[model samples]
Target: MFESVMWLIVVAGGPLLLALLMAYVLMTRRHRGPAERMESDRATKRLYSQDER
Candidate 1:
């Protein structure tokens, strides 16, 4: 009985814990600021412009 209970906890709780952890990480992540975004856009544009040459 104890082994069965442990198995149940491991099977159910493992995914639950992983999902909660993933949610927390996704929710708490910081987005890039405007200056960083502009720099990224410029770099992308530069790369594409070079490809057109």
Candidate 2:
């Protein structure tokens, strides 16, 4: 019974942990300042432009 309960907790916690991590990432990303966002955008554009060569 103890092992079964542990297994169930682990199974339920996996998705909960993943969801928390994803939410944290999304919240941080959404709160970036304009300059920081612009820098990220510029970096992405630079990377893609280099890839086209």
Candidate 3:
């Protein structure tokens, strides 16, 4: 009985631990910032005309 319970725990915990590891990896991935902030990041929220050329 004890050995069976331990085997069950190992089987169940393996997938659970894998899921948590995957979740952690996905949540920590780098993401793009807000669109407005990215647009205004250069000079005072304005894109320079000369910089365009």
Candidate 4:
């Protein structure tokens, strides 16, 4: 009985979790503009610069 209940939760929750993650990814991609993304990428590259030494 306990095993069956755990299996039921896993089956239902897995898809729900995947759907939420997909929605989050889509929303974030839509929210950021191209210029904003470029600036973020530049900032990240500057932060990790190996020539600073």
Best by lDDT: 1
Show where candidate 4 strays beyond 4 Å: 30-53
Ordered from best to worst lDDT, the candidate numbers read 1, 2, 4, 3
Q: State the weakest 10-residue window (summed lDDT) of model 3.
A: 42-51
Compose the digit string of candidate 2's lDDT tens values, residues 1-53: 99999999899999999999999998888577999999999999999999999
Candidate 3: residue pairs that collide: none
In model 3, how many backbone clashes occur? 0
What would the C-alpha RMSD of candidate 1 be, to one decimal place? Answer: 1.8
- Rank order (by TM-score, best first): 1, 2, 3, 4
RMSD of 2: 3.9
lDDT of each: 1.00, 0.94, 0.83, 0.91
Pick by lDDT: 2 or 4, better one: 2
Can you list the residue pairs that collide in candidate 1? none
- Indicate whether candidate 3 or candidate 4 has the larger lDDT: 4
Instruction: Give all TM-scores, in the order shown.
Output: 0.70, 0.54, 0.53, 0.51
Candidate 2 residue-wise lDDT at 15: 93
lDDT of candidate 2?
0.94
- The superposed Cα distance between candidate 3 and the true structure at residue 49, in angstroms, equals 30
Candidate 1, residues 1-53, lDDT tens digits: the string is 99999999999999999999999999999999999999999999999999999
